[model samples]
Target: MSLTREDVAGIARYARIALSDDELTEMTAYLNDAVALLEPIREYDLEGVEPTFHPIGSLVNVMAADDAAADERALPLGIALENAPSRVGRSFRVPSILGDEGGAR
Candidate 1:
């Protein structure tokens, strides 16, 4: 995972970027340092540990109470369309997605 100046230059060329010699040297050092930091994690043993989606244990909702049957309120149609920029009759009016032809191909 060690990166050299030549490797950084090759990467810049492949990405269509024009980097000065100083920039290439700096990028090479930065990438090498990043790889060095990750190298130790690759060797650590994780035999029986479960993969975590979140780093904070409290953030995971392991026992979320079921409130699915709670009374739900619905917004009136007039209130819903109140903030619409454009509306035609009972529906919102939007620009045609079919372009000038006015229908799907």
Candidate 2:
């Protein structure tokens, strides 16, 4: 498949790219070269090759034991929140992101 200068200009417009006439001309040649290189792959004979999603076809999660030194390195709630800038009951209080009244949203 060959691409014209018009085709490249249209592609640039669709992609929201601002290109000078020189740049459009250059990119037209570059994209046509890329398309021409891909044309040779069409000659590959694949009569009965099954399509695959992954190179390593059927992998499962290879999980190990969760011996993460459970809770020994954990900080207590009061100690963790000791220097908090603002707090409400047991939780940190910050500006609401939703920009709604404090009741529902």
Say which candidate scores most in lDDT.
Answer: 2
Deviation (Å) of 43 in candidate 1:
1.1
Over 7-96, each residue of candidate 2 has an lDDT whose tens digit, in order, gives 999999999999998999899999998998898778888789887777898877697567766756677889878899988778887876
What TM-score would every model get versus the actual structure?
0.39, 0.47
Model 1, span 35-77: residue lDDT tens: 8888888897999988877889678557645564452544567
| Model 1 TM-score, 2 decimals | 0.39
Segments of candidate 1 deviating more than 4 angstroms: 45-105
Off by over 4 Å in 2: 60-105
Q: In model 1, how large is the Cα lDDT of residue 67?
A: 67
Report the number of the highest-TM-score candidate: 2
How far is 43's C-alpha from truth in model 2 (Å)? 0.9
TM-score of decoy 2: 0.47
Residue pairs in clash, model 2: none
Worst 10-residue lDDT window for candidate 1 reads 64-73
